[model samples]
Target chain A: MFQNDAFRALDRQESLRLLAKVPVGRVVYTRQALPAVLPINFSLDTDASVLLRTSPDSDLVRAIDGVVVAFEADEFDAATRSGWSVVVTGRATVVTDPDEHERLSQADPTSWMPLRDPVFVRIESEMVTGRGLRGTRGTQ
Target chain B: MFQNDAFRALDRQESLRLLAKVPVGRVVYTRQALPAVLPINFSLDTDASVLLRTSPDSDLVRAIDGVVVAFEADEFDAATRSGWSVVVTGRATVVTDPDEHERLSQADPTSWMPLRDPVFVRIESEMVTGRGLRGTRGTQ
Candidate 1:
């Protein structure tokens, strides 16, 4: 299982497909000229864009408007020490259009915090890449 | 349960304790003037530095040597919609000292891929912060 060729690079389409399945991921953005990462629950739209539901007062909403950010998600089995990780890099835009906002709000991306002026943000995928382990052998 | 003050800030020591329990996290670093995040298996040393195991030729090894980076991890429960996330911003240094290298290598951080020319990197925790939801009511 720990073969020399066990590591595999996932293509763009495959990576996006995986992203659509995972419900939680981390969004990495620049804060005060330094990198910061926050775990978020996200959904994938039909056009492969990532959607996040945040609070209006959230720092992510304030800092990430019209900014490029890296969003990443993965599924790893600690017992097998095998998993896949997908990363999407894109510009985040807050959804203000009433119709789109309503539709996304109805789609109901999970938010742990209480709903008080929920903000919807969309990240259009500019680049997608992933890596996976081919086999499982070692216990994590 | 869904109160306005549900979010609570975690102090540096509390954040480090949570990080020590998690086996995997994403490391955010600057690459070509853009933020890049990658999943890595890590362990916390006595001094609160983040330690990672990777191949010598991996990009993380090449790019993050003596570079400032952010490492983040979280544990969220989908049913209760409660979780805490911790982020550590620090400088990553490749461990080349013979004694320290051997000691870390023996510690055995989980790696899914085959171990060949394994490289150990350390990120000394310069700043650590975390946030957690105090009560669980929403479903995420």
Candidate 2:
């Protein structure tokens, strides 16, 4: 596969577009001075911010609030050895404004684990970058 | 799906088993003081160390060498909202020993990007943890 395909850097716009298409992604944050990643369901808002829903008292909510975090999503094919990945780095803020929270709540980010009293958090993207292998097709 | 199934933490042995099953996983490391995540092809050795092949000059090779890095892999089903994820945190070192390098090279970690001179790196596992949502099966 390396003989036939080449990796290309995706522009910022293209990266964000790909990010918006995926409902599941991994959020990387510092935990005990070590980087930790967790998969979460998310939605991309109109302004390009990444929104996620979790339990009010979950570790993700506590560890990520008001801290810089990285969000990543990708699609790859093992058979063809081709895929694309997008990464976003920014500060994650728990949604607190009543009106804005209500609006985002309507987006309904689904959680695989039972989320009683779901709390919404938004990561305002400060930098976005992505890379893709050309001439490949796969669900990301 | 969360309503029906509960998340269970997997033991270290089980986590390593899952990691070995997947051919591709994401490596997370600090780049310029910011956390960055990249998807790469990998193979797990008998000692539970993660091995990857990349260009000697690749940013991943440079940024991760001698650094504490996090490797993550998962399988999730969107419809059933079930999957498992394993994370290994360890220090990455470029394999320089000829004998060990030759043996690892035989493992055949395929790269999607053209690698004229592939460099092998090993992540010596310092910590391993995993979690799973019960009652689903998929390769991720």
Give me the displacement of residue A110 in model 2, in angstroms: 3.2
Chain B vs. true chain B: TM-score per candidate: 0.89, 0.88
lDDT of 1 by residue, A1-140 (tens): 23347668999999988888766888999988878998887899878889988877777888899998989999887777778999889999999999998888788765666666777899889999898866555433
**RMSDs, each prediction?**
2.8, 4.5
Pairs that collide, model 2: none
> What would the per-residue lDDT of candidate 2 be over residues B1-140, giving only the tens digit for each residue?
34224778899999998888887899998888888898887888878888888878788888999988899999887878778999999999999998987888676655555666677889988899998877543221
* TM values, all candidates: 0.90, 0.90
Stretches of candidate 2 off by over 4 Å are A1-5, A135-140, B1-5, B135-140
lDDT assessment of candidate 1 = 0.82
Error of 1 at B5 (Å): 2.5
